[model samples]
Target: MRIRHPGALWRGAQAAALAAAVCIGGFGTSGEARAEYADVVINNYSDAAGMRPVIFPHWFHRIRFRCKVCHADLGFQFKAGGNEINMVKIIDGQFCGACHNGDIAWSVENCNLCHSGKPGTPTQVHESTIQKLAIQPQAGGQQ
Candidate 1:
């Protein structure tokens, strides 16, 4: 090809580099580009049904909506493992289904998105609220 527009080739290369960076950076080792461990793991009925535990990203949801959205409006209990969440309830527009029913968010059809945790994991809070709020030790043992 004739070297008519040399600058065009540089622009194309830059565009390619940017695209590659975005594609690679958009994903993490796990599925989403967020924390390594989920905020909450719901394994109440997953093990019995031969399915992976449900990894709920509380942090992700908290950033988008207030606590009342799920706690009060959705009737989800404040304590972990308190609410009896299941596929039936979710599909019937209860609990998670209230929002994840293809209207507000993704429906139950996307199983792996929620149940992406390792097998045999128990239902509990992955991260502790106290730990997050606790003051960390300063460098060199200084408070």
Candidate 2:
């Protein structure tokens, strides 16, 4: 069922595809990248040393805690590594201990979850690997 003005149809499809891509990337233009976790290093740090990487996922906690939960109640230091915390502080009510203490994510029993803060850590690592290994069709079998 070939139609005339094929170019117009192609353009329409291209426009639709682009719109879809933008929607996915922007997540409805919330003005932030919607990922499981975002590696954000707070700055104005000297030599990036003060700039410790922070992992934030809007979806994960948004379902449970409000913005004020971490931003205010937790008093998350906005500056890079500004508020260095340890287990002692957490057990007494500070940083992640504010909620992650089993009441929220999983308490002291799950200490290693957030504190370790491993850069290579992945909440779920399968999807990206599969995409990278995807097979692509070649121009010619004997090329």
Candidate 3:
């Protein structure tokens, strides 16, 4: 019999949890893996400010970033409206500010970046594309 390191076990568990969250909650099962959502609206505080709901284009982000980058590393929840992001936390470099710090991507000061109530104008990625990208690797091909 062989003993496994505790740290290795912990990492394995975390990876499993992340995989479950992605497949079950976020992306759904293989058969049901279609378009979960085209965009996410951030209205946690928009109404209070009398502003339009911020439309987050899922397709736009998915194209450039891996799901793990935002979902696991940045701590964004799997479901829409799951992450309670606010302006204060953002300015403090918490949620959106994590990358939109005027360095990694764009400055949060660029209000139009997120505040656009309309769908993003960037290239749209279909659900099939996403599903293929996420599942192909597990099926023995590149992700």
lDDT of each: 0.71, 0.48, 0.63
Model 2 TM-score (2 dp)? 0.41
Off by over 4 Å in 1: 1-38, 129-143
Q: Relative to the unseen true structure, what is the Cα RMSD of model 3?
A: 11.8
Question: Which 10 residues in a row give candidate 3 its minimum summed lDDT?
Answer: 118-127
By TM-score, the better pick of 1 and 3 is 1
**Best candidate, TM-score-wise?**
1
For 29-124, candidate 1 gives per-residue lDDT tens digits of 321223434388777788789898888888799888999889899899976678988888888899999989899898889999998977766566
Give the clashing residue pairs of candidate 2, or none: 101-107, 102-106, 102-107
Query: 1 or 2: which has the higher lDDT?
Result: 1
In what order do the candidates fall by lDDT, top score first?
Answer: 1, 3, 2
What's the count of clashing pairs in each model shown? 0, 3, 0
Candidate 2 residue-pair clash tally: 3
Which is better, 2 or 3, measured by lDDT? 3
Question: How much is the lDDT of residue 1 in candidate 3?
Answer: 22
